[model samples]
Target: MVDIRIPRLNTNDASYVLVEWLVDDGATVESGASVATVETSKSLEDLVSEHAGVLSRRLPAGADCRPGQVVAVLTPPSQASPPPVADPGRPEGGGTPEAAPVSPVAMVITAPARALMRQHGIDEQDLAALGRSLIRRSDVEALLAGPPAGVSPLVTPEATPAAREGGHARPAG
Candidate 1:
């Protein structure tokens, strides 16, 4: 058996988000395969499997995983057992039936977006209104802000926050 750990992608983030699973739990996977994705503060990195075996997923997509945490295990096919479920009473897959994906394909709400939605008491139906392929933290914030920017209130060059604060507009490097 092989342990699939969550690597420390950056120095700043203590925990990372499991963006999505590339393969299903208890499925066979090849060595060096990207089984899932870990989302950091700035980017997402693939969680590669070091061993080719039957995958036993311990964490679901969209859950928080910390560095050095075992998120899955790879068992040699000959010795592979059923993916251990925390709850024997539960079905083969983890999570409640209501925990199904919002859509069959595309449109994954990042952890930050989920947090913001919870904080603001926003509903998933509200986000469904956006009809985006991917929903990020910024998208949720924009929804909370209401109306499209530059629709009702357009800040003039002179009235810009930077300008008013005596800071000039500078290109980001």
Candidate 2:
């Protein structure tokens, strides 16, 4: 099935409105068909079908669409609708639900950190172990690297420069 998504119409708008759909849901149309009308801040443009197939509309006529967001899918004439898959946000590990809050306080995740989390399938439960309300990319990396921050398996106090330089074990009287 080919995904029918809104294209990047302009640089200024972060999202566009799906103004209308020219074709009905599950309608069979030829390639290059104008399937929907999308509205940007500046213009209303046609959304086209990439292939000749049966349209399966995912979003209604009036919906907000980000660039590359799949608003519809086109199943080839011979193929049946694709089987539903589990939500990506939900972990396959049979663990906590995706929306479970890490803490009572709001957690602020940096954009890069969020991207890394998605890429690595690291959810809030994994992040909650971090005990930090603010999550950054380095924190995620440290978690991915097999140890939490500041607690390295390799380095000990004896490995420190001060310890190796013959510093007193206790303060001088």
Candidate 3:
């Protein structure tokens, strides 16, 4: 007899919604066969069977499944019924404590860094090469603190017409 437990896909995920069952109760399922579909906040994933056996019982679809929750029980063909699961709350080995719902803080990279990276087609790895901390706006500003040693600053459209005319009037003596 084997118990199938709902698995946690991510650190911040607390529960999954059972979307559908691919296999029916009492059906003989092969090992590694997808038995059910579960939906987390990020994506939908299929749950696979660990052993080849007859699916004895399955929790109803649309149920909220927590990590380590036994969603189904499988019985070998030779056995009419499998033994009841030892603990419904704990998963196998009983070593991992039940996980509490996790609320992680969202990280927001500063607008300037995001824009600069986008414009330059620079990836996170490339930004790291600049020796910047890569955490906040100040880090990005620090990276841009000075221009490249040999390169000179270029004029932009915002330059005044007189400046564009190459300083029409000479400096006062």
Superposed model 3: Cα runs more than 4 Å off: 81-173
Greater lDDT among 2 and 3 belongs to 2
State the local distance difference test value for candidate 3: 0.64
User: Number of clashes in every candidate structure?
Assistant: 0, 0, 0
Q: Of models 1 and 3, which has the larger TM-score?
A: 1
- lDDT at 117, model 3: 43
- Range of the 10 consecutive residues with the lowest summed lDDT in candidate 3: 153-162
Residue 137 miss distance in model 3 (angstroms): 35
* Comparison by TM-score, 1 against 2, better one: 1
Q: For candidate 1, what is the lDDT? A: 0.76
TM-score of model 2 (CA atoms): 0.46
Error of 1 at 19 (Å): 1.6
**lDDT of all predictions:** 0.76, 0.72, 0.64
Candidate 3, 6: how far from true, in Å?
0.8
Specify the highest-lDDT model's number: 1
- Tens-digit per-residue lDDT, 54-164, candidate 2: 999999766788998999998887896654555656657654444555647556565557676666556666677677766767887776666656675332335333455
